[model samples]
Target: MIKLMRIDYRLIHGQVAMAWTSAIGANCLLVANDAVSKDSMRITTLKLARPAGCKLVIKSVEDSITALNSGVTDPYNLFIIVESVEDAYRLAKGYRNIRSINFGGAKPQKDCTRKLSVTTPVSERDMQLLKELVNEGIEIEIRQVPGDEKINVSKLL
Candidate 1:
């Protein structure tokens, strides 16, 4: 079962390794990103940052989708993390189980002119994709951490 899907540019870190994982009662952290899945250095870094007693699986977006669709992740309470809104969209579109997304953190893009939160910046392309996701009934929440109150992206957009 998927507890949450988050877009955090920094990926696994303090907040994610502790707060979000505990808050959602998730035992598995499934990182769905193309780049980091293939990077040895990043995989090592993420392994070091992983929460104690929690399982961490890093796979490319497509592979992640296959795992989710094939019921391989059903045994664990899964928390999916991606690096961008685009990647989140891809995962959500590919898998029917992802009904909500959390906007955790994003590095500023060259074309970004708006922010969904202090830690999350949004470009025009990002905004359009967000709108599309909202239209499809996917709930979008903006927050830096689980303790913060969720700000609805649909209302803001």
Candidate 2:
């Protein structure tokens, strides 16, 4: 079963490797990012950052969806991580198991000037996707760590 689905540009770091993993009691860290899966150095870094005793599986977005839908991930407590709103939208749209999304870390877009309701920056397309997810009844929130208060995406919408 899925424990959580998170969107953080920095896929695995101290906050995720320690705090979120423990908070959700996740045993498997599934990183669904095509670019990271193809990059050997990134894979190595993410593996090193993963919490001890947890399994890390880095696969392309489509592959991750296949594994999830095929019930291959049913045996383990899965913590899914994606780097973009589009990727998260694809996963949650492809699989009904993903009921919530956490907007953890978003690096600002240098050219984006359209102000969004959220404190941080996001492209207009991404903001639209996020709003659509909320309309679909998927809970979305913003927070850096588990200890921080969850700011619902709907309220900001």
lDDT of each: 0.93, 0.88
Give the candidate number with the greatest lDDT.
Answer: 1
Q: When superposed on Cα atoms, how far off is each prediction in RMSD?
A: 0.8, 1.6
List TM-scores for all candidates, in order.
Answer: 0.97, 0.94
Per-residue lDDT of model 1, residues 1-157, tens digit only = 9998999999998999989999999999999999999999999999999999999999999999999999999999999999999999999899977889999988888899898777888999899999999999999998877878889999889
In candidate 1, the residue pairs with backbone N, CA or C atoms under 3 Å apart (3 or more residues apart, or in different chains) clash, namely none
Worst 10 residues of 2 by lDDT: 111-120
Model 1 local distance difference test score: 0.93
lDDT of 2 by residue, 67-117 (tens): 999999999999999998888999998888788999887666875554343
Quote the positional error of residue 97 for candidate 1 in Å: 1.5
Worst 10 residues of 1 by lDDT: 112-121
Alpha carbon deviation, residue 19, candidate 2 (Å): 0.5
Residue 83, model 1: lDDT of: 98
Candidate 1: segments with Cα more than 4 A from true spot: none
What is the lDDT, from 0 to 100, of the residue 111 in candidate 1? 94
Give the clash count for each candidate: 0, 0
